[model samples]
Target: MRAFVSMLSGILFGFGLALSGMMDPSRVRGFLDIFGDWDPTMAFVMGGAVIVMAIAWRMQKAMNKPVVCDQFSLPGTKLIDARLIGGAALFGIGWGLAGLCPGPAVASLANNLSGAAIFVAAMIAGMVIFRLTERPAQ
Candidate 1:
């Protein structure tokens, strides 16, 4: 049941990404090119998602346990540390360059976009490198 729900949710998310034209790297790049020719479509998509998730977070505060899990698994830290900032900067650089973060990159694979495979491969390699080189949390 859990696996089914997870798979179904992923499918729905990918479908939504496809429907919103998020599978196009050029469209994402246009959004980042704010001074040149900004595409505000993704801003609307992200705004809609933020609104929905805001409501979900409010509802989560009222619940003691999740419907599909034994307990809520929310983030514990709210710290704005150097590590967090550095990670965000790195992510922004990569996003600005490739214009396809993990979610859309994976979703673009379905359409067989020209650079999607290379991007996904690099992303996986980065993850593996991080896992291998990461120091234990103190």
Candidate 2:
């Protein structure tokens, strides 16, 4: 049952990405472009997502635990650290250059985009490196 729900959630998320024009690198690039033919549609999409997430987060706080899970899966720490800053900077640079973030990059794999394939490959490599190097949190 949990597996089915997870699969359904992923399908819905992928559909939303496709419907929002996020699957197109050109649309994302246009959003990032401030000088030439800049587009703000993606900003609105992100803003909407943030708003929804904020509401969901608040609602989650009122509940003792998640209904669908055996344990609470929320992050335990809230701190501003070098690792967060560095990761954000790296992500921003890559997004500015390729105009494709993780979600859209994964979606692009189905479309047979070569750049997306490379991006996904590099992203997996980075995750593996981080896993191998980082100490497990206490």
Candidate 3:
């Protein structure tokens, strides 16, 4: 049941990405192009996501445990650290360069096979490097 729900959520998210044009690198690049032909489509998509997430967070706080889990698994730290900053900077640079973030890159794999494949490969490599270098939680 939990697996089914997870699959459904992923499918809905992928469908939203496709319908919102987030799967298109050109459209994403246009959204980032503030000084040029800037597109506001992505902004609307992000706004909607923020709103939905805000509501979800509120509901989460009201719950003692998740519907399909023993307890909610969430980030334990709220600290601002060098590792976080560096990772965020790297992510931003990659997004600017390819105009494809991890979610959309994976979701668009079928739409742009070669480009998405390269992006996913690089993304996985980065993740592996991070895992290899990261210190164990104290």
Which candidate number would show the highest lDDT if scored against the true structure? 3
lDDT of 2 at 13: 92
RMSD of 3: 1.4
What is the per-residue lDDT of model 3 for residues 1-138, given as tens digits with 9 covering 90 to 100?
A: 899989999999999999989888889899999999999999999999999999999999999999988989998877998878988998888888898999999997978999999999999998899789988987
Write the residue-wise lDDT of candidate 1 on 1-138 in tens digits. Answer: 878899999999999888887777788889889999999999998998999999999999999998788988877877898989998998898888998889989988878766899999999999999999999988
Give me the runs in candidate 3 sitting further than 4 Å from their true place.
none
lDDT for each residue of candidate 2 in 1-138, tens digit (9 for 90 to 100): 888889998999999999998888889999999899999999989998999999998999898887778868867786988878999999999888888889989988998579789999999999999999998777
Alpha carbon lDDT of each predicted model:
0.89, 0.90, 0.92
- Candidate 2, residue 9: the lDDT equals 88
Off by over 4 Å in 2: 135-138
> Residue 14 CA error for candidate 1 (Å)?
0.5
Task: For candidate 2, report its TM-score.
Answer: 0.88
Q: How many clashing pairs per prediction, in order?
A: 0, 0, 0
Compute the lDDT of residue 51 as modeled in candidate 2: 97
Clashing pairs in 3: none
